[model samples]
Target: MLNFVEYTTQSALRNAGMRSVISFGIALLFFAATLVSFQVTDASAQSACFERTALMKHLSGKFEEAPVAAGLAANGSVLEVFSSPDGVTWTIVLTQPNGATCVMASGESWMGMKKPKKDKVS
Candidate 1:
């Protein structure tokens, strides 16, 4: 009787151990899948069309103030638009966080109008 009980207990423990390991493996697989999905989404999001109308339409009303450099300078992995001194032409560029600059689009006769300031009531 004693030997039978010991054998049964050992078998149960072994089975429980196997179950734990399998559960851990499944959890790890799920975690890896989530990471891969995020990476793919991130890569796709970073991609740009490099077309004029597409870029202009996407970047409309999203322009931010950027500083002028001697030749050309950009920072961050975001789309940016720089215009000529007369504001008649515009150049769209993508600057990566690693300091890489890619000219996405450029056009002549580009004009942007500033929004009218709202009168404040004191």
Candidate 2:
């Protein structure tokens, strides 16, 4: 009887060790999956066409200003437009352009820019 109990104890220990190893493997797999998902999300955000969205008010003929346009390029989409003389109380209004408003927002980082309009030609 004594020998039987001793052998059973050793077997339990071995089984516990195996279970622990399996748990560790599962944890490693989950960690790897999380890392891969994070990398994919970061790469997609950087590759996207629009880095950020902003609302700009047309100040004058070809000028617009905003508090923040960190990722706005010269040719980014004009999602929204607002205007204010005091820069505090803004009014949402649509303004027309005078000259050939080409895709000027491309390649140039802008802060406050007029709302972009889609070109008929392209």
Instruction: Give model 2's TM-score versus the native structure.
Output: 0.39
What is the RMSD, in Å, between candidate 1 and the native fold over all Cα?
10.2
- Give lDDT tens digits, candidate 1, residues 63-100: 42232332334443666667656555667677665655
**On a 0 to 1 TM-score scale, where does candidate 1 land against the true structure?**
0.39
Clashing pairs in 1: none
What shift in Å separates residue 65 of candidate 1 from its native position after superposition?
32
The C-alpha RMSD in Å for every predicted model, in order, reads 10.2, 13.7
Minimum summed lDDT over a 10-residue window in model 1 is located at 64-73
Estimate every model's Cα lDDT from 0 to 1.
0.65, 0.47
